[model samples]
Target: MIQLYDSFHQASKDLYYSLTQAGFQGPVVVINDDGFLPEGVTSAYSYYCQMETGQGRSLYFNQLQVPPFWEITGTNGDGEVWDYSQRKAKIFYAEPKHLRRIKNVDWFGPNEKVRFTDHYNRFGWLFARTYFNAEQKVTSRIYFNQAKQEVLVENFMTGDIQLNWQGKVYFFDNRVELFRHYFAEMGWELSEIWYNSLSTPFFLSYNSPEAGQDILFWQEGIQEDIPGNMKVMLNSSHVRTQRVLVQQRQVYQKMMDILPEEQKAKIAYLGYIYPSLRENAGRKEILILTNSDQIEKLEELTQALPDFHFHIGALTEMSQRLMAFEAKSNITLYPNISQKQLQRLFQECDIYLDINHSGEVMDAVRKAFEQNMVILAFEQTIHNRDLIPAAHRFDASQPTDMVMALAGFAASYPQMVALQREETSNESVTGYQQLLGKEER
Candidate 1:
């Protein structure tokens, strides 16, 4: 059986599903340090144990008590190929069915840092990071010299290699277009690509399969702006990587729940999108500070609430478009509010409504909370769970409930005021401290 290196996340589910959809039938194993998994999962999950193959047509990998080396074996002639030099052992068979359960054996080795199998798909073969030492940060250095079967054992390994010398290598890229170009240039063989959201040189390469059989392995840290089904090919294999993936897994069904087919027929009968009773002008002073992409949506909202004046701040051309629309709608636009000016606006406004959750917005809200200002926001996600109090949350879909909630908040001025201040003053996380210890810098 080909060993697939999967990180414990939502995408693993997607990848497993994709493979199953492609008619590959086999037991899927999900492993993690914590061993916590979702309900209805059947795979074997374990923690704190080493893996290996046991005796008889069985696959065995043993975890030793101490470091330096471990042993794995496949009896019944599966083939015991060991690269003692690289400290990697491979059990290969022409047919996958001949192998038995892939047993986990305990192992402790000072020299074993990273190890995993090479995978060759319809796209191509790629080596993925299966297991690595957390304390040992391998340098950007890979050492190999005109060899194909032998891998050099090293403490620090790095470099840009098309393939590793131990018959394992990877051609990793983020850009889809660039990947497609390169794949064509390299004669179109099976290869896997690694992608992340660094906004660096990564995240632009993809090789669109001519067969239209692209399978999406959802990676961690992907945002909502990228649609759930955007990269997912229909009737394909899939996996989910993190908690956010759980949210996406249900987004389509949840949206359907929000707007049923019957409601669609009556949308036009309601005349205006929103009712007039609650659409009164100037009911509350709304301070809207957005970074530009959301300006036009805010403008439409301004049209709906004609009485309430708008003070908009944006940073892009699209934000400028919001400015033009606001002018036509007779609303005020603060095109570029400085940080100090924004703080003052927060102080003066009756309600603070940002587009969605944001780190900078959270800081602003914290300031507002400290000043005893009322803040309204959509349902919280993991990112802002710690920042928001239960009392200040408003539903995104239920405008009537949201308005009622806001009104209730307004009537109860200074409600939880002390609590809000206390929460704001609580110690918070700092990225600088997270990346580097206070003493290191």
Candidate 2:
């Protein structure tokens, strides 16, 4: 069995975890090589680079090997490499500070024009380099082997790829063809294929005759109509796709409502089996993880609920305006919080306030959801609408409504959580086992 995906985003990661929890064993192959992936997930670039398993050191900002005069400054999200006063490059991390390993670096030329980006593997090797044109458009990308030799070259303008393997040279018209070649070279039996995308992975499964059964774990959202590709997978008998599992309950219902009865037979609703980390202590402790102090109506909410304790934490130091909240008897502040502290907060707190502005820090909304916290937010301040149910969201102007909802939740915590879980559609291992039609190994 093989698990194929175009990219390893949050949805893809959830699918991987869900499959593993259901006792499905397979090799995961990602088409895009962002250089930062969870353990055991391999990318096409990694295979071309001939990266050995468990090899190479972790690449850090200080060891980036920049110019002698360049200095590196760290921030909450990423690091900046500066040449004297001018910015030279921006360093990104898979997990800032905690992982401390370099994911990629964007280099700037004269007038701070983007020249190219160097993608580094977590194993600390430069595996790929993508160049940009004067107009800031991607021109080409070069994939490197462990010996630092060019193994493949991709042209963005023409959608072509040139591969140099062993002593032979091969050319492909597009990425799909290049990926198909990679699978062929790997010499693995494509008997059972599990994929999560309706694009490249769908095409590969549709075309590969060796694949006996194809299960598509659809992660994308659908609106009034089902996607054309998904329709093809469900309606067409010529394709190998045997089942289409929708990860979101709402999307699955929409698809079911639109498709015919025969097509509906091939579809099922599936959700991630998130590990429960929360304990219902009836403490009424609320947690807010933020990168900015622009928490909408924070003072109003805090003042409205005198009995509830608000715990606000940040990866960086808090400003004076935010620090003033420390004077509140029911409010606590955690500046420059550590991972251990964050874990403790997630466990101790039963409710999470998704009211902070600016970008989310450390995927906080998902973390809170996984911790089984009752997440509430103002519609404007909510970062991820998918995880936050519509009923839990309120208007920014109606602070009283939010306060009333919080009071109600605090009054009946367990009942509210049960309703929240039902809306979120958190699944179990048994659901996956039935979908896969196999017992746990």
Ten contiguous residues minimizing lDDT sum, candidate 1: 267-276
lDDT of 2 by residue, 363-434 (tens): 888888877788888999888887787888999999898999988875777776666677776788888888
* Model 1 residue 136 CA deviation in Å: 13
Candidate 1, position 41, lDDT:
31
lDDT of 1 at 183: 41
Candidate 1 lDDT score relative to the true structure? 0.35
lDDT of each: 0.35, 0.85
In terms of lDDT, which candidate is strongest?
A: 2
lDDT of the structure predicted as candidate 2: 0.85
Candidate 1's error at 412, in angstroms? 2.0
Residue range 258-373, candidate 1, lDDT tens digits: 44464222111100011011111223566765544442235444555555555555432334445566555546666545566676666566555544333333245544544445
